[model samples]
Target chain A: MTGHIYIIGMGPGYKEMMTDEAYQAMKNADVIVGYTVYIDLVKEHFPDKEFFTTPMRQEVERCKACYDFAKDGKIVAFICSGDAGVYGMAAPMYELLPEYESQNITADDITVIPGVTAAISGAAQLGAPINHDFCVISLSDLLTPWETIERRLIAAIQGDFAIAIYNPSSKKRHDYLEKACQIMLDAGTDKNRACGYVENIGREGTKTVVCTLEELKNAQVNMFTTVFVGNSKSEIIQGKLVTKRGYEI
Target chain B: MTGHIYIIGMGPGYKEMMTDEAYQAMKNADVIVGYTVYIDLVKEHFPDKEFFTTPMRQEVERCKACYDFAKDGKIVAFICSGDAGVYGMAAPMYELLPEYESQNITADDITVIPGVTAAISGAAQLGAPINHDFCVISLSDLLTPWETIERRLIAAIQGDFAIAIYNPSSKKRHDYLEKACQIMLDAGTDKNRACGYVENIGREGTKTVVCTLEELKNAQVNMFTTVFVGNSKSEIIQGKLVTKRGYEI
Candidate 1:
């Protein structure tokens, strides 16, 4: 019997925030595979299910194991923290799906389940910082070049779209977010542009700070943080970040 | 006794796609309020809960009614399709929240539950076309001017980001999607760029079509259709639209 591979992103790493569809997929799977950190988040809920994990930088191997398990007649649930379609395992998994065709595994044997991404979950935490047209860009220059990142940041600012930044900073790329802000400022964006950041989204110790574009440049953020920069119409109304939708009130 | 307002975006109007938190909020609400079309989608599931609905273009009055209900000590669930933070009621609700201060309602009295937005949901149906940095833009020129929309389209293309288009066309603006494609071409995007569109996402009669940027320009899509134009790294792998994550497999 050829089993199925279910690629699911359980939003913010919380059970409550997970969609019923994702939860059902989790329950239906014979085994779950994910990064070690994400696997730890769901361990308690599915204690008996076999779990296969890999650390950071082992995504290729992790996805391969998922296919191997599913090909061996075991239903597999491959998990990521946010929506897999956005900076998650969905694309990578699809990129590798072709190699397993001889084993009778086809695209039909795979299902990608979407979840609330950090931008949406973080936006809810910040009282809707992305209430208008927005762009989500990652500051991590791992696969994508720094030049491409710079161009996207500049274009987002020029479009006057609210921005959600992922992987804003790391140990080596600690100043990338700062550099991004400087580039936007040089592109004529306002220094006082409304911005906010949420750390540990949908988890314990989740923290949010709303600030101006100037303050965000100097703010210290880690990999767990999701950053938001509001559009020109955005404002901090009554202590909540919101962008008006042009409703005649 | 003061009550609370739960603002939730249940993606694609499907019960399964709703997060556990959103489902719980719906179960706990004393009454539910939304636009008539959206309210009809949930009415069958929560037959016992009171529902208040207004027609389209009455968003202002509809939100005001939610505040009135909440102020009158009834827990209210204000529903929208997809993530509320994305062009939904979250921003408008926060904008109107201040007017009820004398009634003792504050920001703390509201909770916005995020869901998988159409961009993410539609991307899943298309096999992960948005695997890289992406910008979400709406074609409707109701609130935003057409000139601004054109500029954003150009910027998105120039930045080389995959594009997820929302509200692509309406009866009044049927040619907006076509216009957007032309603008991207003028901005130096390839006419053969991989693009896909999904209609009635997560609902019955859901349909998806994969085409090029040129083909997308002539495709017939309505408000329910979410269009995705892949980035430069995107390709069709075994009949699936996928963007590579630069994995060395």
Candidate 2:
């Protein structure tokens, strides 16, 4: 039996948005490993596969289970949302794979397929918030220091780059997006910048709104929301949003 | 007769990569307009519809033609590769729509749908250069000033953001990517950064390589290539690329 591991990106929570490549990989796997939420998302596709689920923040232990099982020649798949490489499970698993390889316990068969990111999907629902030049930053500082996040926010503001803010805020990190907006306001003209918030992308009850930096500071945002801040070149045109590419007259 | 304009993103040339929503929109269009190259890409899908093709640098004229025909209550689509909102015909058409509306041209309605972007497709093919925080910058100064582009590049480097460089160089402008890389080298550690060149993503003859910034400059690149420059956290792991989110050990 050839032992293999496939990392799949489920995409913004819509069955239609999931790529055919990713679906095929999932169907071929004998064992599926992921967070409980992600497993629930794709449970219908793998009704008969051996399913392994982990609670939140237990990534290391869950990945170890897959690695141990793969050593037994099991066809295993680790699932993620969006692209597996973008804040997904691929990195953590890669880090641990070396240790297992040193022990000669796992084969070198790992493949990662890409999926549509929430940032792009959310931006699509609204007008183009990322048309010309832009940056995406995660406001949650679970791994990175708050100071680092602050510096990136200030740099994005000075660069005049459109920005996508992921993991904007959760129950414990409620003030991060507020601080980000404040940094932008202090760096330049607050009224000139445009901001948008998209919640539950590609899922039912999706909500999106466009506002200014000042308005965004007080906007009701959550972990499910992805916010976009337009650069100086972006504008609201007759209710249709646009970020100009500078070539236009 | 309801005049409507469906601005469609054709994805990255692979029909399987195209979302079902985008395909449905194209199928419903009665008259499709786009640049000659993109028109040729989707010719097979709409053999019966009226196809209008324009030469390069004739965006304004092409958009005018789309608007004029759409005013007759036709289901018109302006085709573009990737997503229509990103570096596509949607922005230019949106900019010119008001001028026509002011002149009593009210018969046409407009809708813009998102398509997969070259940056995402390129990142996917190259193993996720956009896993964490990243930025996208176009090296072309046709519509934007080089000074503005320089400032953004400086900011992206200062923030340690991963970057995607589009339109890096053409026949007339070959020094943009070199100049941009120099700016990054000046701001960040030269040896630690990783860069990738992904050409013709999702299309035949697709080629991708992950290397250092120095190596990328020495490598052959062209207009079809989308370059990804990883920040401090990116690494080339066992020939499979990965970008760390700093969330893991």
Deviating ranges (above 4 Å) for candidate 1 = none
Candidate 1 is scored at a TM of 0.98
* lDDT of every predicted structure (CA atoms): 0.90, 0.79
The TM-scores of all predictions, comma-separated, are 0.98, 0.91
Model 1 score (lDDT): 0.90
Q: What's the distance in Å from true for residue B160, model 2?
A: 0.5
Interface RMSD per candidate (angstroms): 1.0, 2.6
Off by over 4 Å in 2: A1-3, A45-50, A65-77, A102-108, B45-50, B100-109
> What is candidate 1's CAPRI-style docking category based on DockQ?
high
Name the candidate that leads on lDDT: 1
Q: What is the C-alpha interface RMSD of model 2?
A: 2.6
